[model samples]
Target: MTSPYRVLRSDREDPTVLRRELRRRTFPNPGLAERVRAILQRVETKGDQALVELTAELDRIALTPSELCRTEAPEPPAAPVRKTLRWSLGNVRRFARASRPRDWRMRNREGAWVGERFLPLDRIGVYVPGGTAPLISTAIMTIPFAREAGVREIVAVSPPPIHPVLYYALRIAGATEVYAVGGAQAVAALAYGTESIRPVDKIFGPGNAYVVEAKRQLFGLVAIDLLPGPSEVAVVADEGARAEFVAADLLAQAEHGSSSRILLLTPSAKMLEMVLSRIEEEIETLPRRSMVESVLRDNALFVLTRSLEEALDLVGEFAPEHLSLAVRHPRSAAKRVRHCGAIYLGDYSAVAAGDFLAGPSHTLPTGGSARAFDGLRMDHFFHRTSLVEYTRSAIARVEPKIALFAEIEGLAAHGRSASVRVAGRGRHKENGPFLRGRPPSAKVR
Candidate 1:
């Protein structure tokens, strides 16, 4: 059960060594901007008709808005639903209803009552990925957040892996309009305001490399939640940790794609061995054995450390999307964790628990974004602005000081303005208390 990447020295701290051990680029694709821009232009020129033609040519789904927008569609959870797209439009409605917000106001230190005013974006387009698989949860996680934020006129666009049953989910999720489109073009339709669709102020949700690239390129032109990257997980396990739990977690991330990476850090040689054996044994019977193997070969790393402290140090450096602490006292280990999108504590609470049913947001920072970012929450949908007010007496009290500071900066006009308010007359600029209103060349007695 010994891991192939065990470190003999637990306390080794050479700067170069640490860098080499943990260094990796979670985002590497390039040239996505040019590609996405081209597609956005095409969609803008063609409109709704363009979107239909693109759907048929790129995804093999011939769809019209009437066909794609529906309250309910067929159900093909793990299999093809045939002819029409299969989705749960009602579920989208449920999520939207659950996400609405309440008005808020407050009194500030200045005593002038201030509050925020909330309004919905004029229009928004939903991006549903239907290429490799149908993503019902994607609708739940993303569209609901927008709906809760009071976004109006939400539309949807996606390419059907088969036909176009998936659009039904968009309708259910509070989408007023829907389109059968996918890839960069879908992003384009949302960004550039194609004849069929209006350009939006922002774009949301995660997608493939091409889609992610499009988002990145258009960041300045439009707002985005966060950049999507390869899936990643890091497991911190103690001697008592279960090998089955550790192996299953690695496999779950592995199934994301060949690019996805998983890491295991443990203080127990015996535990590491058990996990390795379990991984090898389970892969043969895995539903996606080929994917598991390919991921392990391309981006996997298994580390055996001398103690839990060393494991903790390495885990923080990676800042994985999902982190599971399977130690004797999982809570104790969690206190040391400074970085991780989500943490699954204890053997009973595995990564899978947080993936689906956990009340916390599943959309989290990936790559090394955990270093400065947090998982998506209701706050992500809101923006903050400050209100400040000062009394006229307050200005009078500080005018003398303000005048002196302005004179020091050689802004004669600024000092005049500062005193002008104090005088309540023409040119109410404050006289410099330090200079007693004398010119710099004039003597102060």
Candidate 2:
């Protein structure tokens, strides 16, 4: 019988062909993009009506504008579940606080007061995936960062029939408003506000292809977090690594959905065989066995490398969202991987830990986007503005350089704008070049 997953051997296959197979398509399907474009256009033009119609058509759940924003709060989960959620929220909050950017000022060589100030967006939206899974962890992973950043209004949206646990998580994570909407329509409503839902300054969280495409289409209309779509994991394990642990991690990611990508890179053929066997045994026990099986058969790949180093090199090419280093000296091996969204070191460090309980936000770039984008962070909720204040003396010092640049760029007004401040104006004791005492004409010109 043929194996469920395709196996590529470095000794047998061409490296270029293997790499081509490993590389994920960076662009969305044109057909998918067109469909998402229609949804976005509908939402942009029709507002709440489009949202209601699309929600019914796509999600198969009818909703009215009045029912879009859920008014009543959901009862908290059971004690044990609530305790676990609190534990996870606490870790996420601490991480957000610790990782938040700080405002700082420093004098440049010309002694200009230059710095950056980060301010939280006044309002933002968080999209939680409610299909296949409630994704309660998504709320904890996304919203606390905005709350910790001091965002005043946090809007959370999920599909209809939102799970009680997920609703509870969203409220606990600091969403001021909750909406019963999902898919591209929810993203469109977030980007282009409806009658009830006001537009957010930025949007966060992850979703399926339609949602990711919607974010991509609406990027300039509203600030967007990185494109974190689907789930992906690449495990690099050696003969010394536990096959059970490696197989479990692969299956865990596969359980996310059929679109999820799973990869196993091993130098030892015996290790590869063992992991495949373990996956077959373990997958039978999973409740989402069909989904996991579909991912394993279609989206999974097993690569046999000449060495662990070769496997690591392939990992860089793949740029997986989550990387597991299940090998001897996992930490040292992790140091060599530069492109993955997140890394789990050692056999005991399951990717599920990072997905659910880990302090870091699991809203990470997917579909090879890890090559360019980073996982969502607390700072993503804040907008950064560069602060520049140049004194008359500082302006004088840089005027010649500015004049030269203006001359090169053929913008005489640009040079004059700088030179006018220093050229014959009386030296004032004010801190900035343009101050309250400056004439309106001087300030304008």
Candidate 3:
């Protein structure tokens, strides 16, 4: 027997490993704030010249204005990928349309009319980071939401892609413009407009540690969608859970990046043994095996809990980016969760589906931000403003009480202002020429 193919269980816990994960979570990159702030100040002061110089220094993609400012993404795709172009574009359009609002209105107790109105930002910048591989979904996930928000102009910045899929995604998602700038410098250009690139009201999309830090620094000058940390997922599984499904779910999140944290909590030690075997067997056939291997060996964990109840408690504590209920009753298990950006019910719906076509926004709050925040939705795009109308009678009815309260607070002008309307226009100027403050009746009445 060549050693039970994947039952390698380690009851041995590493103190060093626990310390490393804890440190990564609480303390972000030191010196990032000062560095990004300095970069933003330089960009704001220098404008397009700064952008051009930064592109050369940071992105390694030197560009003149003509080369960098793309009115539209490049041409479509090759013959094979061309077939899928319309379908992909249509899917993006459909999601965009579905996420937009109808209208809203309401009447107040004063018979004064009031309602909420949603308006879109005039310009938006979308950052799509690519140092290693181009993320086509970066455009897909972000642009649709911006369009749905009714943003008239969408400028997308990426580290210049040689790949066709990224250009294709930008084209399909309907970004109005594209730029070749990359990293924190790109973020600065978007904040304080250059001669070529315009400042945007808000910025959306995700990136590496540097890009994220830039967004954090620029948040006050412009609205940022969310502070994205590393990608993470937690799978809560129980007895009779498919080992293949559990292993696959765990590996999928692990492949996101080396820093992504993936976890599998199960009540059964036997099931844990089964999943480890299944993961080894499946890894050989995977396209991204090396990345998955790093995740499996370093970033992922399989924990043995006292019971299913304890497993749920742990998942709640983690509040990961993506969560899966791989237990017997997935629906029931999902209900037990108090926090998570998105919840996958049962084994059939892998995290991939939610990432791509599912109606909900895939731009989730990560790194336990889910404890207080929520995933991206239409609400993230638009804010509400109240409308109010008060008639003469509405003012007259509340006048007496308003005047008395105003006088009580020593704001005599406030008391008379309310009383003037009801006290007759002639006496208004002289009504207060009585007692030091005038009796309460002379005020409100």
Candidate 4:
């Protein structure tokens, strides 16, 4: 059988070819985009009827409009599982509360009171992928942030056969409602709303290609967190890094699915060889062995770089969803990285920590989107509105500048709006033209 991973030596390969190999295209290839577009349009036109049809056809689960929303309570999880969920929820809640944005007021250059107030979104939908696994932790990672942000309504949706543990976690995380629908249809229902399900102001969480594409297509109609589709991890290892630890992290992400992207960039060829050997040995132990193997065979890359710096440069170009720096000075190495959804430093800092127990939400930008987008955070749940208050004196001071701008733009009414306020100031108002409802001079010039 052919080796699962392909290796490239930077010293031997052409730079142009290496660059082309590292670049990943954004999600929803043309065909996927068209399909997602049709799903969205179907939902928009047919509403609940489309949801039932799509859920039955795609998810293979039959549901009535009423069954779409899960109202009955889920069975409690085992004691050990419940304890773990509570512990994780506590950590996520504390982190979200501490990191949430604060309202502030300050004086501007013109002495006007200007600041921003952060308000929680009225309602939001969190999509938890219920594919091969339950993804129990996604609830803790996503919903509590919205809860801590004070969002009034937090709706959660997962595929049918919703895992009991997942449903319990969503409730503990403060989800106001739970739905049993999934896929592009779930996203469309959340975005456009069905007869049974109301639309939310913003949508959160991550999922498969269809879920991400649905978010992309419905962006203007509803707010979306980010295009956090498949999982991705790039590990930059040095000679000092442990081979077993490096290999374990790579395999951990590979189990996410075949679409996951995994890269191992190392300066030490010996380290590379050891990790490859270790991966082969560990692959046999995982229950999801075939899934991991598929990812390793098609999506994994092992690059031998000239130096650790070169490897870091390659990581920036890749802009992986998860970055692991297993080097002598991982902290220092992390300083040079420009793009990546999240960075895990040192051999001991496993990406799984960030994925499951770590306070940071695992819903991160994937497919090279880290260049522009950030991982999910508490602040994403808030709507920031700028607060501006101008005193009479402050408006008077800036009136001339406003008039100049209006005159330059030929917006006479724009200047008059501001000028009228200043014009009315200090006037005994009974007969003042500014107060008599007369229009201000048409020409500010």
For each candidate in the order shown, give its overall lDDT on alpha carbons. 0.68, 0.89, 0.74, 0.89
**Pairs clashing in candidate 4?**
none
Give per-model TM-scores: 0.77, 0.94, 0.83, 0.93
Q: List the residue pairs that clash in candidate 2.
A: none
Candidate 3, overall lDDT?
A: 0.74
Cα TM-score of candidate 4: 0.93
Number of clashing pairs, model 2? 0
Please give the TM-score that candidate 1 achieves against the real structure: 0.77
lDDT of 4 at 316: 93
> Tens-digit lDDT track for model 4 on 1-445?
1355898899999988898778776746899989999998999899999989998899888988888888887788999999988988888888898899977665667766666778999999999988669899999999999999999999999999898889899888899999998999899999999898899999998888888888988899999899887898999999999999999999999998888989999999999999999999999999999999999989999999999999999899999999999999988999999999999999899999988877888888888889899999988999999877777777889999999999999999999989998878564323222112333333222
lDDT tens readout by residue for model 1, 237-295: 88888889888888888887777878888888788788888888888988888888988
- Weakest 10 consecutive residues of candidate 3 by summed lDDT: 431-440
- RMSD after CA superposition, every candidate: 9.1, 4.8, 8.1, 6.2
Q: Per-residue lDDT tens digits of candidate 3, residues 134-252?
A: 87766777788877778889898887643567776786787888887777888888888888888898888888777788888888999998877778888888888888888888877
| C-alpha lDDT of candidate 1 relative to the true structure | 0.68
Model 2 lDDT on a 0 to 1 scale: 0.89
Per lDDT, what order, best first?
Answer: 2, 4, 3, 1
The residue pairs in collision within model 3 are: none
